[model samples]
Target: MQTRTHFTTRLAALVVAVAASALGCSAQADQTTDKIKSALVSRLGIDAGDIKGITKTPMAGLYEVNIGTQLLYSDANGDYVFNGDLIDAKNHRNLTQARMDELNKVDFASLPLANAVKVVKGNGSRKMVVFSDPNCPYCHQLESTLKSIDNVTVYTFLYPVLSPDSTAKAKQIWCSTDRAKAWESWMLDRKAPTAAGTCDTAAIDSNLALGQKMNVNGTPTVILADGTRLPGAVSGDRLEKALSSAH
Candidate 1:
């Protein structure tokens, strides 16, 4: 009985030692994170609000910094920062882009579809969302590419950030009797919208704010049904593959 009691006591002490070591390691990690964050703000002139998170990467002494949807890497001291793709050569994977894709994902169900110009092609079975600026040439190019895509419902949020003329055109498109048709006509044929920009166009302003909040820094930002964010104009084949994989 005495031997058993002694073994139990030693086991308890061992468990306590292990737990204390874990706590110490956790405190050290927290301190490292705080030091890195402070250094980034002071030395790099990065906004504290924009620093969403800082985590240690698999590489020794390397840390990953997440700012909005952008991914950056820094040393433990934060003295060195680099912006580029981190590739796992052996596995043939892009770690940085994979993380960005995860960080940029938006919940499809949370989108305000009513505020967007809805375009239905074919049976309109698949769904996607796009943030587009009227005057952005890339957006116009994407619109032409979208013509070949069938069986997809696209929700376009008029994000007028290029110029005042873009805002005016977006207002006219939103005020038009048939928003989808007006958007296609103007985008496809270079025809200006004829509707007076006098209707309730609060949705346009709302879309602008929403785009900013979502970190949509460019035109023709596409979001698939599964919350995959495509930052620029993608080919119809790529869109079809993404749509198929999403379903």
Candidate 2:
């Protein structure tokens, strides 16, 4: 299953909701949004044949509108426009969550796995990837949890963003005797690796740049085999559960 996630919108849903009552009684939210769509077509002088689905959202003044593959919002009365988050102040709910949930999935999978060192357990029957920082407390917690799982292949990218010291520690791990064993040992036993003979190891810098490009701001961002990204530390049992249903 795709994980549900929400984006922070720029406007308040309360404003959209407040504008809903100002709409004509003959106009439903969808119809009102259509009117906005029709107006835009007339103004743009397009054929207006590409319009597909229109729906009313919980947003106060704006309508959550979809046209073919494009997504936008229009005022309840077809007066204004919107292109960002729709926040609900009363319930503290995000109206745009469902839309953004499927947005970043593809780019998540396109990440280069070769930059990450692989760690296999048991028969390697399953696969998951983790972005971790050597010195992050949460990453340590995730490392402990991944220990219990079996028959799984793990690709770990050392994110190393805690501080300057963490970068040094990560460089040592990347240049250690055994990339896999050294990582597991360092993470599980707090056994810091010895000084790397060469200080010019590229793995640390590579992972840092990769993390930045992938929007991995913190450690322990676990991406399942199916390309769905889950951000946070998860338990062993929970990890197993996720694997069971993941592709």
lDDT of 1 by residue, 32-92 (tens): 8888899999999999999999998878999999998688899888899999998889999
TM-score of every candidate relative to the true structure: 0.91, 0.62
Sliding window of 10 residues with minimal summed lDDT for model 2: 1-10
lDDT of 2 at 93: 73
Cα lDDT computed for each candidate against the true fold: 0.93, 0.73
Q: CA shift at 14, candidate 2, in angstroms?
A: 42
Candidate 1 residue runs with Cα over 4 Å from true position: 1-20
Q: How many backbone clashes does candidate 2 have?
A: 6
